[model samples]
Target chain A: MLKRTPLHDWHVAHGARMVEFAGWEMPVQYTSVVEEHNAVRTAVGLFDVSHMGEIRVRGRGALPLLQHLVTNDVSRLSPARALYTPMCREDGGTLDDLLIYHLGEDDYLAVVNAANTERDLAWFRAHAEGAGDVDVLDETDRWALFAVQGPRAEEVLQPLVEADLKRLRYYHCIPGTSLAGVSGAIVARTGYTGEDGFECYLPAGAVHEAWEAVWGRVQALNGRLCGLGARDTLRLEAALPLYGHELTETINPLEARLGAFVKLEKGPFIGREALAAAKAEGPRRRLCGLRLLERGIPRAGYAVHRASAGGPDGSWEAEPCGYVTSGTFAPYLHQPIALALVGGGAAPGERMAVDIRGRLVPAEVVPLPFYKRGAAAPGS
Target chain B: MEFPQDLKYTEEHEWVRASRDLAVVGITDYAQSELGDVVYVELPAVGARVKKGASFGVVESVKSVSDLFAPVSGEVVRVNGALADHPEKVNEDPYGEGWMIEIRMDDPSELEDLLSAAEYAARVE
Candidate 1:
């Protein structure tokens, strides 16, 4: 049986198409993918990201335990600040990417991908066995996460949140605040949509009431009730890496272009030696963006080949240089775009061909993100 | 989903409208709703030969790609050129402007193999 979130019934009532994702029955789209995608890009959108897992680490040994577990410097996180980092195995491959929030001294919350919750929790517990005063607790069922994103996100959330939304900076959080009538909610100024937004972490039982309070304001702004489909596309346009697609067990942070988040200078961590060696050796394959020059929708697992020539009539090289990690018809760009991990000196401005099914669709290797809001979109 | 009474349907979720030996084809409303927002549609070129129960084109949505199976063997007389630029027509008007191709049938009696509107609706339900 698939696990259901607190808002599962609400999603069904709102005409959302439900799909089983990562062992949870979640809404893939509330209306249509394009409409929801456009809503987040143009205005504001709300998402029930309750499927995301949360783990709480508390006690005197919390900081030391976290420092050893993740690649980023946990000590750099001040009070009410969130740090994005990738947790890796001893082999330097990504275990899961996490967002650790320092609620207070010795109190932290690490948000992980839904599918990796149990594994991450087990890993944390195993590491904390010898570490003193560290309490690793699985809080996945204790919280319900709601993400309100886009340019008008503040306008919709400001009136409901007691904390000053304007005062919250990026990658910061306000803990123990009343949000949408739910007291003690965590309002974090962080999101996956690459927009100015807040992630409201409410008590699991209070989510229904909180959702009702926020939805009214959301509707006033013509905001949409987005789902996982829109969430995936929004993150893709932002060039954010998804756990399974971009950062797998075999794919390290360096190859995934998330080297900035991995702090090797912070001293010894789980994958420090391997990661440092991998860095010195350089990346085996680098993640890059691809935009189709022809009319074709590139899908995941599609073969990416070097183009012999530049036009639609050009032929593809026999050997595939890479494979698409995530690809879709990017709604905001109104074009088919993809993120691929390629080797053999592929860079921006080089021509490539994506074997979409059997057809060699002409494409070009572009910059990372396919769309950016205020700035000019690359490869447009 | 609207299943036009005048059209015959296939289990693959395609609809065919027969006019003498020429047949107009497109995906049904049910198919469009199931696929979500249509982004691209690849149709066979004009004068292309298609076989019954074989894939004749491709329809891509934001999250998935589906094959448009031929309901009857025929020679394609015309193809929808507008879909190259405006694929949303498949979701907006699956039975009307979204018509994919006009096929000159090799055997008009093949329409007997398709389900009626009521049968199609029952099958989908």
Candidate 2:
């Protein structure tokens, strides 16, 4: 049986195409994926992200436990700031990448991927045993998370929020605020879409009313009721890593191009020794962006190759070098783009090919992000 | 999802419009709407041989890809080249400009095996 969010019925009523994702019945899109994706790029977009898991850790040991479990320096986090980091196993393999929000002194909330909820909770419990004075509790069902993202996100949400939206800096939060008449909501200036946005965590029981109120303004601005499809495209365009695709149990932070979030110098963590050694040796396969030079959309698991000269009949052939991790035809760029784990020192501007259904399509190694906000729009 | 009375439909959600031995092929409205926004299409080369119930091409939407099947066995006389640059035509006008191929059917009588508009509509419903 698939789990359903509180907005499942609402999504169905609004003509959303529901699909099973991560063992949950989630909305994939409404009218069209491209339209929803473009809406977030040009205007405001609302997302029902209640399926994400939130685990709470409180007490004096919270800071120490967090610093030991995650790759980032959690001691730097304050009540007003949030941190992003990747938790790993003993051998430097990624467990999951999550955002840690400091709800209070010695109290923190770690938002994790829905699919990894059970495993992550268990990992936390096992580590917290005999660590110190700490209490780890699963708070996944306590909140309904909504992401209001885009250039006009603030304007769309400011009217219903009590706190000053502009005052909340990026990666900062106001733990207790009123949103759409709901008190004790957490409004944080953070998002995965690479947009100026806010993520509001409303009490689960009162979420419907709050969502309805905020959605009214969102609809007034012609913003989109985005789903997981648009969310995936938006994050991909911004070069944000998806756990299963870009970061996995076998894919280390360094190989996934997330070294900035991994603090090797930080005193001993679970995977500290392995991570430090891997860092010194340098990653064997580096994740990089690939843009198709010819027609053909690359998909995950497709073999990436070092392009060779065409055959006599102009047939394409190449030697395998890597494989694509995540790819799609970018709506904003109007071109096919992908992230590939390339080996043997593949550099930007090097010619490559993606083997698509027995055909080798030409491509080029490019920079990470396929799109960035504030940059000139395509065809401008 | 409109199933034109003049066209024959297949269980695979493809439609065929035949005039004598030559047939025009395109996916049904139900198929295109289910697939969502079309981004790319792969079509068979002109003069390629296609067999009934065989996969001939590919139509890729933003989120997924679907195979285009042959409704009837024939030789591909032409393909809609415009879809190479404007794949959205498949969603905008699947019956008109979005038609995928023109096939010279080897057995014109095979059209009798296809479902009528009413039958196709009922099957989808």
Candidate 3:
């Protein structure tokens, strides 16, 4: 059976194109992808992220239990601060990438990918067995997540939220607040899009009316009601890694270029030893950015080969060097961009070609993040 | 979705206009709206012969790809050059500026196989 978020009916009623994504019937687009993509780049956009899974760890030992599961050091995280971390397997392979929010003294919430919720919970239960006094609960059903993103996101959200949003720095959050008359909402200054935004976590039932209040304000500014299509494009343009694409059971954080979040020296975690060994030995494959020089959209699982000396339809036996993990014709950048897991030798500025089905289209290895928004101006 | 009564539509959601032996082909507004934003369009080269009900081209959006089937047997007289850079025209003005190809149809009678605007609308609805 397919799952539907609390906002599913609202999205359908508003002319959103619904598609099955990650076992959920989610809205892929409300309008055209370009319009929603451009809206986030120039103005503001609202997104229903209620499909994301939220797990609660409530106990005195909540911090230590999390410290043992993820690669990042949980000791550095204080109340109301959220840090992105990659949970790994015993062999240093990635299990999932998620956000850990320190809600208060003895409560923590781990927001994980919707598709991996079941597996992640099993992993958590297996590890938490007699480890501490922590009690793990899958709290996904109790919360609804909404993200207001883009430059004008603060302005669009200011009227509805009672908290001072400006004081909420990037990567920080404020819980136990009221927004649109709903209490216990957690307003976090984090987003997958490369834009200034707020992710609000509220009670599931209250989100329906809260969405109306927030959407009404954004609509007055010509903001968009974005969906999974724009969400994927926006994250791609920012080089944000998707779990199945960038991180898998066989892909480690170091290989995926997520080593900065892994605190190896912060004491032993699940995969610290293997990760440290891998770090010393170097990864066999590295994830890098690719820009198609030819007219081809690189899709996942497309073979990446060394550029051939012959013309478009070359007879040369292409050496499979890598494969694309995620690719799209980025609406914001107006070009085809991709993230590929290539051989360890592949570096930026090198020439490569993507075997887009049968035709090998020339491409260039570029730096991560195809786009980033400009810095905010002085106090305006 | 707006289905112009003057144009002919296919069960596959394409729209066609006939002028003697020549036919102008484009996807209906329903088709383009369903496809979302068209980022790339793959069309058969000019002077190519396309059979009715056969796959003639490909339309790619940000989410998925769909094959463009020929509404009628015809020789491809011209392909839409504007689509190479501005494929979003299929979304912006699917009926007018978004016309994809002009075909010297091999059999004008093949137009009878396509659906009328009202029929196509009912089928989509």
The fraction of correct interface contacts reproduced by each prediction comes to 1.00, 0.81, 0.62
Ranking by TM-score: 2, 1, 3
Candidate 3: tens digits of C-alpha lDDT, residues B13-120: 888999899999999888888888889988889999999999888888887778899999989998999999899898899998899989999889999988999999
Task: For candidate 2, write residues A218-310 as lDDT tens digits.
Answer: 899989999899899889989999999999999999899889999988888988898888888899888989999999999999999987667
Task: Please list the Cα RMSD from the true structure of every candidate, rounded to 1 decimal place.
Answer: 1.9, 1.6, 3.2
Residue A329, model 3: lDDT of 93
Report lDDT (CA) for all predictions: 0.92, 0.91, 0.90
For candidate 2, what is the DockQ-based docking class?
Answer: high
Please provide TM-scores, in order, for all candidate models, with all chains considered together: 0.97, 0.97, 0.93
Residue-level lDDT of model 3, residues A23-76, one tens digit each, is 888999987888898898889999998989999998988888899999999889
Q: Give the better candidate number (1 or 2) by lDDT.
A: 1
Query: For model 1, what TM-score is found for chain B?
Result: 0.99
Instruction: Order candidates by DockQ, high to low.
Output: 1, 2, 3
Q: If you assessed candidate 1 against the hidden native complex, which CAPRI class would it receive?
A: high
Cα deviation of A15, candidate 1, in Å = 1.0
Mind giving the per-residue lDDT tens digits that candidate 2 earns over B4-108? 999999999999999999999999999999898899999999999999999999999888889999999999999999999999999999999999999999999
Candidate 1 regions with alpha-carbon error over 4 angstroms: A309-319, A375-380
